[model samples]
Target: MHERMIIAGFGGQGVIMAGKLLCIAAMNENKYVSHIPSYGAEMRGGTANCSVVISDKEIGSPTVPKPTIAVVMNTPSLTKFEPMVKPGGLLIYNSSLIDQKPKRTDITVVDVKANDISEAEGSTRAANMAAIGKVLALKPEIASLESVIKALDVAISARNRKHNDINIKVLKAAFAQK
Candidate 1:
């Protein structure tokens, strides 16, 4: 299986972290993976995004010109990446921040109230994790929820380990959605 994903949002939205978590989880599952992150000079609040590729075979390039899955956490990101998703691909957008709906009819679109769910779970910063969880739930072939939880242990640093429990909770909460 091959999955090309683009995760995007404002810099502080954990877009890079979500990509890292997906790579780490895919790696733990013994899959070939690649990740490339991009962000503006201003960092937090500025635009941020990452391309992640997971496959059973070797990857030709790290860049994702047209992604099979696009997870957008904000309106700007939605505007930028929505048209870039391949036909028949999946688009997951955070409804809490984006009021506009996707225009494409060929691809599947799913909306998650990531910020609201994360806030309800205790931390709004974990909205990225929530979004990832939804992705995993919708496309379990890419990576399992267990692998992603384990990835948190590896992706999150020792100093920030305190947030692991909350992040895990958010992940599970989102994954449980129907």
Candidate 2:
């Protein structure tokens, strides 16, 4: 299966980290994957996004002009990426930060309370993991939850590894939402 995903949000939201974790998980499952990250001028509060492609076959390009799944963590990202999802695609939005609802009728939309879920789990920084968990729950073909859990060992730096437990908790919490 081929899955083109876009994870977008403001800086410090772990948009790129989420994409990286997904790639690592797909790689652990022996799937072909590509990750491309983009950042706005400002580091902390500016726009940040990444495109990830996971497939059973080779990927020709990393750019995702039309994504099959779009995970938007903020309203600005929702406005920018909502129209870019392919018809019949999946759109996961962060309900806690985004007050606006998606207007697309052709694609399936899921509102994930990423911030709230992560906060409940202990850290609001792990909202990205929560969002990724929701994505995997909806589309298990993209990557298994076990593989993603294992990926934390590789995705998170050694110094910050102590937070892995909280991240895992956030992931499981979001996954159970399905």
Q: lDDT (CA) for every model shown?
A: 0.93, 0.93
- Badly placed stretches (over 4 Å) of model 2 are 39-46
| TM-scores, all models, native as reference | 0.95, 0.96
Q: How close is candidate 2 to the true structure, as a TM-score?
A: 0.96
Candidate 1 ranges beyond 4 A from true positions: 39-46
- Which pairs clash (backbone N, Cα, C closer than 3 Å) in model 1? none
Q: What is the Cα-based lDDT of residue 163 in candidate 1?
A: 98
Model 1 lDDT, full chain set: 0.93
RMSD of each: 1.9, 1.9
What TM-score does structure 1 among the candidates reach? 0.95
